[model samples]
Target: MRRARVGIDVGGTFTDFVLSNGADGSLTYFKEPSVPSDPSLAVERGMAALLDRARLEPGDVELVVHGTTLGLNAIIQRRGAAMALVVSRGNRDVLEIARCRMPSSYDFSAPKEEPLVPRDLVFEIGARSAFDGTILARPPVEEIAELAETLKSRGVAAVAVMLLNAYVDPTLETEVADALASRLPGVLVSRSSQVWPEIREYERALVAGLNAYIHPLLERYYATLTRRMGELGVAAPLYITASNGGALSVDSARARPIDTVLSGPASGVVAAARIALLTGRQEIITFDMGGTSSDFAVSKGGEPEYTTRTDVGEFPLILPVVNVSSIGAGGGSIVRVDKHGVLKVGPESAGADPGPASYRRGGTEAAITDCYVAAGIIDPDAFLGGRMKLDRAAASGALERVAQRLGMTGEDRAAQAAEAALSVTTAKMATELFKGLAQRGLDPRGFALIPFGGAGPTHANLLAEEARLAAIIVPPGPGTFCALGAIMADVKRDYVRTVRRRLSDDGAPQALAATIAGLEREATDWVGSEGAIVEATQLSAEADMRYAGQAYELHVAIPAALGKTMAAREVGELFHQAHERLYGFRDVDSAIEVVTLRVRVVGRVPPIAIPELDKTATAVEPKGRRRVFHRGQWLDVPVFLRDRLVQGQGFAGPALVEQEDTTTWIIPGWHARVDAVGNLHVSRG
Candidate 1:
């Protein structure tokens, strides 16, 4: 009786589940149509089907790790619980005054993101602390009592307390929060220091408030999932993927749901990294294309970059997370020419229900898929393995409108317009990819692009061409890569403490050392309680620092062995080295200031075995040629069956490799080879 681990991912269009039995190393995948209005319903239904598909009793399953976009949806849709903020008397407008930057500098009509908390819901307390952690002002007891009464009167379900300089010492703010929570039973309360003990007041408060806003919702959701799982007879502790490429127990996730907002993308990055390691690739880039959007990430030395300032919806979060980019225009993106007669792809998606015009679900506009059809790539009847039929005439009819608008005629014009639109979208994606990599001093040419999702393999060549990538690795199961990633993440958490000071023996070394020690102890305690192997605890430490007078800061790694014993100059030199590597210049003469110290605790999950491909399988060519679209002309293209392709076998364009779940196209002049591990390496001639 081998234990089984399940990974569930809830996407915009589909809910996917992957179950891996540790004993036999068997993998099973299942998909269910997603319900946008209520995602948990889809999860429940999908889990039941997945369990049944595996033909295993619920009690045989040992762990079920899951990832969802519920918190992200709440922030994007502004549908979280009605929440209020409590700030220092003079900082009641913190949310509105966020960094004071508009989303778009070119569009004058662009409005600012609606603040999560309205003006009336923002109450203030007369409590303040200086940057040096000295209490400057404290509100009277009666005033706090009245403020609590007022918040309750306003029907606020959650509250965030952010007194000025509370990051320096959260005692006053925590006392105030305790009083409010005591008075208003069942009301969620979040303190800025507890959430993000960094210096930026507004950003910290937003993180805490966002956490509070989604707390109740996640609590209820997790409770329901637990009950449903119990009903199915599984009592194994549930785990949820976090944005940092790790897993959290259901209890930890329910406490800080914001950490999982970008978990879906993180999972894909992790999955790609694992595959890269197994396949002997040291550097890789992952492209994940789903129904609504495409995401990409770069990994070096088998580790994905982590960031603490990722944006959730329009709000910035202060939690550390795996760095991944949303760079792909998904399969559902509507293609059209703007009023200027210039063709554009998306930031807008048609979603699953009304997907592309070819789906025959009443869509009228042309999309990327229509262009693929016009160019003779995707088969009209073989989509989803012919389980779903796409209307080629409808697709061509819609694309003709685009061709006419773009001043073209015949298949040449239609195919050219479609190719050009794809080129434009690919260029946009490549540019974003460049920026994300540039920030880390990474070069695209050094990495292989691993494209997944529905459109990942289909569009990988075009994107790889635009990004100038050296190689592309089409994974064994590219479509469900993220779900696979969720199944692979280890259980982990992060801890932080604020310790602002200049680095010197006389400056705040003792204080900084104490702060770092305290954070490590806290991290150790939390990780210890998770029941992971006690002796195998892995702890990583880092600090946030900036040159004095600079408005921004950079996070630099601090090896855990140093712990509190690290000297002041050693810390300062770490920032200088990191800054020089990133910016190509270091401010050697500038004084350095430490803003925060962070520790990451990771408890390794059980190891996963990589599935070996059957190299003894035979290879075959296409049954026949089809008039497929490419380069503005129809060519008789040879298609190969991916399942039949064997290791060390090679194929060249103009060729189409077909699989049950996806299709890979090798554009003219390019070649593809089946590697030893069964991955398809498509690259330039």
Candidate 2:
């Protein structure tokens, strides 16, 4: 009668599930082909399959933590519900004038992002608030009624209200939103301050708008998901993973869907961070190469880096999220020769339905996965533990077409094309990785690359070689790593308030302390309301500070003791220290302004135990040998079963470690060994 906690991650090509036994901490993984039309269907299927495989009844599940890309897909695909915007009279073009920056500064012809709410659907009201929380004007009841009627007539499913200076005082805007909701029943209304109360009007407006835009779609989807789970008789509290590498109650996610939009990659990063902590690695870069794209995130000192600004499609997201960058193509990225005779690896993906040419699902184009097959790097018969057999001939044919386009005439033309395509893809990823690390003032040589996702380990060695990385850590169950991360997530939430005042100003300390105290109360209350999911609660604080008259602000963590005391001099010193760390020097004489205060509440869940492998001095034997293409030549490589290798066993490349979900390729110049926890550590010779 061992209860289980299930974690799920819905990806573009598959829905991954991990069932953790509550007593023994044993993990069982499953992956089901995704249903893009209805992602929830894939979740249900995967859950049922996982439970059956684990020999557990649905009722034995204690909790379910799930992450999905539904909201993210909707935003990227522009298929969300029609939404309208309600703003103060003078600020109608907030989305249109977003930061007044072009997608490309050097390219004058670069088009601007299409506004989420069209100008015709943007209704302006007389409600306005001064910068200091004073209500300047309030829209009349008649005007509110008229606006509601107009919105209803326009057939918009939701409305986002973003009055000017609403962050200062949300009451006026909330009142208007309430009135509108009352008049227009069934239409979802999201207030700017409620969604995100940051100082930037444009960012705040987009947050509310994005939330409203995806509300109806997610609400319907979740309703179906909840009903399905109940029908299965799980009777577990379902939690949704969030962008900040944490979990939130499903109801909380429903209210603020914006937080969950970037949850997929963040969950994987969280898992990588935890793995780094357990493995005693100080700095690691996570590489998640899935079906559609490859994402990279940096973790240092066992913590994932976070950023306050990231992009969702063409829109800027101001919420705090784990900093993950989409570097290059993934498994299904199409490979083609352009009209100018230049070979390209995708910005376009084959996706799940058609998938790669080797999937035998009607795709005819050469994709990265197809190239793997053509190059003989992936054994077509052994894919997915032989559950899904790939079509090698079709893959070879697809690559042959690309080779013909490139005028390759050798008998090994297809294999050569595949190797070349992989080289191109690896180069692209390495370049982007270097650029991302450079922006953070980091060097690739200082960090180990932790590769996950279905294809991450298969291509990790190539990436590591191209990027000149120090090492690669291939985790167990790499394909379902995101799902593993979801179960390991803690209950967390963030709160923010703007307090624009110089550190030396009169009563600044008292104002900062008051704001922090209020935010802490709110955070604790919210965490408390989340039920008994966590064993303990912790609070952390950060401040957005900068030199007076600076164009930008830097986010600096505030010590817990200093946060509680709110000493102006100490906080100013923290900002100065951060400034000097980022830039070479700090202006000690310059006045520091604390623009925003942020508080995070984390409810710590009981840690999951990672089962260690049995130590053995015996040398591991290769299950078989295969010919793999590398650098324009085919070489015989030893293929080993990943599960059969025990701890304290060492091996050298060229070798392949195959498992049910993925394969790890160790190139000729690298050596690999199994750690105590079953992670394959590969390093340069």
Candidate 3:
């Protein structure tokens, strides 16, 4: 009669589920092949299978936290609802002029990104606001009525309102949006300030526009999912994971779908951080390699790094999100020889439908997964715990084609091609990892790589060796780690306000305190409204500070205790210290300008206790041996069943630890040990 909390993550190829028992804290993991046409179908199918496997009924579930890439895929594929933008007069070119920066500096032929809303679809309004929160202009109701009629005629399913200086005072813009919504019965309406009330008009407008663009698609998906869940007899409250490494109520997510766009990867990073803290690792890099791409996120001191600036497809996103960078190819990334006779891994993926040639779907091209099968790293009959059988001949045939394209004539040409392709992929990932760490002034040698996703553990050792990383921590059930993360996430949200004023100003101290206090009130109110999901609440604050005349500002954290009581001088000192730490110098003599204030609220959830694995005094033996192609030679490698390995067990490479979800490859130069929590700690000799 123990209640279960299910965490689900919908991926490109599979839908992952993690069921945590409320009474004993034991966990169960399951993965189902994704339904590309309707992702909710996979969730429904997976949930039923998982409940049956665990001998639990749907009514026994207490909560369900879910994360999806539906909104993200819609935006990336340009398949979201047809949306129109309503902006202040003379600001019709906001998205068009988008910082006026070209995507590539070296490629002159690079085309600019297509704006979400076309120029023809963008309507102008007289509503405008001044920086001081004063209404400069307001459009007549008749004008708004006419605009709504025009939008309806144009067949836009949704509309976004973003007037000039709407961030300062959202009232006028909200009124305009409300007016439009009243006229347009079925169209969804969104206003800039309600979405993200930052100072930048372009960024604010994009936030609202992006929210509206994906709102209809998500609404339909959520509705279908809710109905399906009910049909399955589950009455638990549903929570959706957010981009900021947190969870939001389904209602909240429906209102602001943009916040959930990056939730998929963010969930993995969140779980990685939790694992880092539990393992006492101070610095770690999370490497998530799924079907479509490989992503890397850095965590320090048990917390994942977060950024206010990131790219969503071709658009710039200013929303604060767990900082995750897409590094290189993944399992289904195509392997090909370019016309110049140079081998390339991918920027194009085969995805789930065709998947890899090994899946025996319709794909005829060689992919990374096919290379694994061709290279003997993956056992064709043992894949997915024998749930699905892979075709080794089809995989080899695909690689053979690529080998022929490379003009290789040996009988082992396919194996050679796979080894070469993996080498290319590893090199690309290592280079990108180094570049990302270098930008943050971090050393690759200082961090342990924690890899998850279906293919992450399978490729971790190769990446670590190429990057010269000291170690890797392969967590238990790596494939379903993101789903586990969804269960561990707390209810969280961020609030921001732009208050551009120099600390030297007479009223700056009171203004800063007042702005922070107001944001805190809003944050607390939001957390309170999240219902029984929150066990306790915490608040943190930060300010965007810069020297007067500086083009950019640095985000400086203000201590929670001093948030309301800190004077202007103390705040300036904190900024100076932060600047010194980051840039190695402080412009102490310069006047400090506070451009924006940010507040983050976190609602704590009861932690799930993962039981430790049983220990054994006897040395573990290999389950079998597999012939693997390594460094141009085929070698017989010992393979261990991951489930049979006991805690405190130690082993050396070259070896393969096979499990239901993934396989861990320990190269010849490394050693591995199992921790109490069943995580494999692999390190160089």
For residues 45-148, what per-residue lDDT tens digits would candidate 3 score against the true structure?
Answer: 99999999888999999899999999888999999999999999999999999898887999989999899899999989998888798998989988998998
TM-score of 3: 0.99
Candidate 2 off by > 4 Å: 616-619
Prediction-by-prediction clash tally: 3, 0, 0
For TM-score, candidate 1 versus 3, the one ahead is 3
Candidate 2 whole-model C-alpha lDDT, 0 to 1? 0.92
lDDT of each: 0.82, 0.92, 0.92
> Residue 199's C-alpha lDDT in candidate 3?
87
RMSD for all candidates, in order, please: 2.5, 1.1, 1.1
lDDT per residue, candidate 1, 12-33, as tens digits?
8778778888877877776676
TM per candidate comes to: 0.93, 0.99, 0.99
Q: Rank the candidates by lDDT, best first.
A: 3, 2, 1
- Candidate 1 lDDT for residue 206: 89
Pairs with steric clashes in candidate 3: none
